[model samples]
Target: MARYFKYKSTADVMADAQSLGHELALADDLSPLFRPVTIGGRKAGNRLLVQPMEGCDGTLDGRPDELTFRRYQRFGGGGAKVIWGEATAICDEVRANTRQLLMAEHTLTGLEQMRRVTRAAHRAECGDDGDLLVGLQLTHSGRYSVRKPLLAMHDPLLDPLIVDKSTGRRVDASYSLLSDDDLKRIEDQFVVAARRAAHLGYDFIDLKQCHRYLLSELLAAKNRPGEYGGCLENRTRLIRNVIGRIRSEVPGLLIATRMNCYDGIPYRGVGEGENFIGQPCPHELPLVAAFGTNPHDHREEDLTEPLQVARDLRDWGVSLINVTLGNPYGNPHVIRPAEFPPIDGYYPPEHPLLGVLRHFRVARQIQAAVPEIPIVGSGYSWLQDFAPQAAAANIAAGHVALAGFGRATLSHPDFARTLQTEGRLNRKQVCRTFSYCTGLMRAKDHPLGQFPTGCPPFDKEVYGPIWKEVEQRT
Candidate 1:
């Protein structure tokens, strides 16, 4: 495998970027990352954000388990002011995994307790939770739903990639699509989930519309007939309705969306083991089943629709927008520029730095398009310890309002706190983007059908044995 993270210092990283003819925004003064930012009339203590990351450790009945509470407690004390909670299923049937957190009346108390534990931890470490903005991301897994493939619409490219657990065969044209009424029911569930989140004292709720989930797939449902497909207006009808209903019903709750600006075509790994390289699946021109992608050339991004969606979301009362790229199940490299691919993934077709630049460029475009709303930027974890510098630079440049961290947070939950006290991240604890967490996420041989994900390399006490078992099995 080709190793990319060889920089010994930030200066070296800058020099490498310079040699690649890409100018990376790196600030010596990281104050931009510490500045307070307002989202939905509420002020976050800092520009640092903990991006929603699922541990897949909830109880089978969809309640937060011990590991779930532990993950949130660490994030709470980690110093990020905006805590974007992980994807929680709006109902039991739509869960992506058996243990995916489900927001329902039966599990509301555990969810509430989980939030309390997080806030308490934050108060204990940071001395107060006044400026803390905690939120939950409500979603329907759609095609990835663990119970079965609950598809919004069928795509020739994506269909073959989905394996039906019952038949142990890839999904074909015979697979049914979710009806309009089904979608409406899902939208209603989102409002119900929003109410539950508000009742639990969550400052905001993210209508999860990213990573090819039901809502995200709907955004690309141009070929599907009816009210929730074809034209952009039709495609966004469900989410817009959900937002309007939440505004009418749950008056005080803030609405947000972790949206996909690009949904590139699926890819497959070729060759064996260490030699595997990623290549896009066969696709025809004008790829109709994807959002924010250049129809003529699926490899490139076309943000016209995404930009319009952002403006619409803002006008419709969306308080914050977390900008992300590519579906993790298909184009993982585009969403996460990692040094090493996950066990099921392939070596990146492009340089990891190039992937990082793509994220910066795309986010800059979206942020520039919608300057009114706060945009949380992703794809920074691969930068390792220098992520804060890049985040500060992006903030200083007005490219993004908040710097969001995902895998990095799993490894170094106290990154923000360390930056505040020590002025830098602990290099030893910084995420190298090995994708071990993702590896765990993909491992389904466990008793619960999914393994909890954490930084096994650093948080060895908890995940080390788990990682060992995964390695042995794989």
Candidate 2:
């Protein structure tokens, strides 16, 4: 493999990571990191993953968009190995955000669009490495949403975004309690979506078991207070049931998850003292959304209990795990600084709830203890940093491997090629645009002009009128 001198004597690799455009690869060694892997026979190229972001880019009524297609297609254009689709609502009634990707096909046209996404990946122009593989993230938002009313693991307070069908005014937090039958119906819908995805030809499925989605909330004590709560077994039942069904039903799909508890083991928490956000290690917390305010003081291997549970789940047959730390609904200010993007409303720093750091050890510990399952380390990171030093840090800490930059990969798809070879990364400029983009993105499909949204272009069109509206109204 071709070699480049390591960033020596405080040489700023981060700067070199910028200015990436023409060249695609940095060195041959970084090639393996970008090549496809034969997973259960199907190829998931490169270790890079396009981390899912909720976008109303899809029609609110549940249809795919050309924008959605092109968005991911660009990531494919950038050449990530596994591309995660925008979170698609399993049930139209249970959407986490109004702008979520809806899998429910209200019409033949809807199915056609989804099919296009699948077909594009297989097209040769996407890359010589073979089209990037696609994976769908199915979510059932339980409580932690700013969206409309919906069903959940437990009844949720009316999400602030709920539009009162009767009065057309905002409603208070209302929990549309779900029953056993309703739960069954929703579960069936998820199955139907998975079946539909398999039918449409997605390579893998990510059961949105992390964050505060229905699966995680159900697994979290928030949803199942009594018999189904407290114990890890009770919490995991929701995910296991989903996995079991998908494995049994979807003949062509592979299943994976982002989780807090591996099995039934309630391991120790990661303290703020040991790990915090931004700083890479030791100071890093847990996986994003996995860190709780109360941290566990246990050493990596101390959790023999959960190790067995992880063993059971793997035995149950989950192939990979995306690790982040923090309770889905607990707190947002923990991981990175609160006003992370430091602008209006953009990608806030990975929430403390996102547990952006727990993977430092939990990932490797799981690898050491379970050792069989593929552990994906995530929480918004730099992939080019995976240069031997970062890779070794990951192994020493316990992450089986790296899940390269989410936005960076989005911006610079050829990150691996550029960083390793040219000693730089050809990145998309808007990445640091952060909250400017994230806030709007987080808002999903709602009309713009709500915030003094950034973007130099906005100065020309909407910002003036928006302020005029505000001034006149006020």
Candidate 3:
């Protein structure tokens, strides 16, 4: 039933790309992916990084639950030198979902245990953990917060999409925006979380600024007045302030960020049943509610400010950067190219290969601009069995410093090891871009309000039953 990804070989994939008027790169020699890269004076074992893939399996009080420990243990042994931890809430009130992890004093022991288990697993599998770099991504969910819709700035297009759980109604003009004072308090929380991460011996802490979360949304608040809005300088004020404080207070701790290079306009499914296709929402332009997007044409990328932000982040002491595209909530295809959509999602408007190419091109621009800093490129999971070849090609061409995998890692944790030892991924385990993990994420009818997401097809033992449950409920 899939329209794309019918290629039997890498050559076939490339030929299809050519037919689509895009050049898809593939390298038979994958050595470029095995080279060690320096980040904050520390050497990661290789250029492969496990992008922060949230499990959403934490406890009610914000501690890593049993499944959380298991997921990280697998990732630890999975062979990626840099295991970027999942997004952990800065405070309880800002959690994106009920089961989202929280980094705080009460949960410090649980976090330490999670790290300990991950490292132990890595050592058990790889024989040593000296070259491993583990980090925790700290975040504030903002408009997506489960408690309520917390706004940084109002967007006519996105505001109507946010249904405040507390009121069970979409937010309107009357919904209060986060005040300057509120942001100051949130900034302090970020610092505190970073300090906690350092105290717990995390290799680094990620200041999450992607996916239209609080900080990401702030980047597009050009029309809003005050310190955290308007011009680029003001728009990036909160992140800049948080980075400065973390550097001053937690001196030796390294800082990283997963930032959005482009935030495309929101889309909605327009057709019936299986025939549904994504269609852009009606909106007036010049679009002022998005970052790295052309105001006159919301669909086209204008990375001038995004490039500058990368440069500024480098100068501001961020050791490395992860470049991502689109707001997952608004435009899933741009962020994650998939063959099939999630249960509540729409078919991708363009070819998934084109979406993957967009990631490579935008990431190449950022990597070139900040040549001194390592840039982790995303959107590779859609490549399926050929992801490694594509990653190698990108690294060889100097398009990106590291190749990050999210859904791929969930399906095959030992992807790096397999590539190094066998030179190919286990085809049986490669994620097919079916969006089964995403379907589990969208299933919120559980007693705890979320189903732990993993590869329901490949990781069948744990997630298979969960998927069955979701099917029954939905």
Candidate 4:
């Protein structure tokens, strides 16, 4: 029942969506996706934005090495107007992976060179990049931090899921939570990082607050007692203050956020049939501990706070808000609808279509409420060849300002180009959603492994043998 991608027709996709109690619509003409958009006085040539997906292959000093530069060049030449640069660490201590890119004074030169090549590639392939809006995502991995699982708030749902790399077992350790003073320093760090990005000529900076990151975790800090916790104003003070600083300091630089409107807990229960078809057991945990969740009944979603947050961000003069859901660390299927799970992932609790629908439905709600702010809608990669159809429909209907792709970009960097020129995606180049890229990443965290990430099958020269080796070990 979960293998919805096996059906090869749009009719089958629609029928499956109906079976899952949702509606999936598509546009006949995808011109809306190629339309230009303006944000914070900056213009993007097209509505196709690349999602900020980390390669975990940067230099040890956190600079964009050869692999990183090549990936961005492909993305630029591929015709996506907005190249949402992958998450770069604001501070070295909070780096997600050993090789995660870092935005710092020392590494600025490498980053600048990388951007030059990317824009050069864009001009060489797409003719011009005058309207191109390239942004850098500033992030602190928070509880998911590899260097130190830094915490602003203790999450009931996610705490148990943290496995110690040494033991490979779930054991809670007293990793220090950031004090209010520490939070202030981190806020300063973000501002400093933004200044660097502006100097590097990044069109925008995405203050990433999604997928259970530090900022997102702080939003769920209802239990913590401090000036930066308890109430909504207190909880969001960090991001608000950080943005306020950037706005005051960096005059015309665009600001955006990849925010999670909903954060869901991982499902745990007995498998259904021989094929594990039915839904997993309901998550019985109380949801008040998490942001954008019902306090009265934890299982249900309450978007009141999330919407208010959006409105507040709009008031803060944010240009774009990339709408996504769930923590990839804990609930990846919610954010990415994969037919096959990652190496250390779970069977999808629902149809991939339902997963895709959740993103658009939530995005539509936010778009209607915050009409002033343009939004980049996620979860379309699961649509495969039909992604452009669905994305264009949403864009034309005024549901979202742009259609974002991540995993699909890894396999087919030329997807947006093909979609624009041929009016359809090359079926062979479309991501089959093998999730081998994610598998390679997960493999890195297992005991002793360091595998470079990319679409193993598509990028066979390097990651192909690594994928085979890792597959055999697993």
Which candidate leads the pack in lDDT? 3
Ranking by lDDT: 3, 1, 4, 2
lDDT of each: 0.92, 0.49, 0.93, 0.83
Q: Name the runs in model 2 displaced over 4 angstroms.
A: 1-32, 107-126, 129-131, 145-177, 222-227, 261-309, 327-330, 333-339, 342-359, 382-398, 402-404, 413-423, 427-430, 444-474
Off by over 4 Å in 4: 163-175, 269-285, 296-299, 445-449, 472-474
**Model 1 Cα lDDT, one tens digit per residue, 1-474:** 788888878788888888889998688899988899989899899999999999999999999999999999999999999999999999998999988999998999999998998899999999989999999999999999988899888898999988988678789988889999998888889999999899999999999899998889999999899999899999999999999999999998999999999999988999988779999998888787989999998878999999999999999999999999888899899888889998778999888998888888888998998899999999999999889999999999999999999999999999999998899999889999989999999999998888988999999999999999988887
The residue-level lDDT of candidate 1 at 94 comes to 91
User: What is the TM-score of candidate 4?
Assistant: 0.94
- True lDDT of residue 88, candidate 4: 95
Error of 2 at 465 (Å): 13
> Candidate 3 clash total?
0
For candidate 1, the TM-score is 0.98
* TM-score (C-alpha) between model 2 and the true structure: 0.69
Across 202-302, the per-residue lDDT of candidate 4 in tens digits comes to: 88999999988999888888977788899999999999999999999998889999998888666542464435432323455455466776765643567
- The alpha-carbon deviation from the true structure for residue 265 of candidate 4, after best TM-score superposition, in angstroms, is 1.0
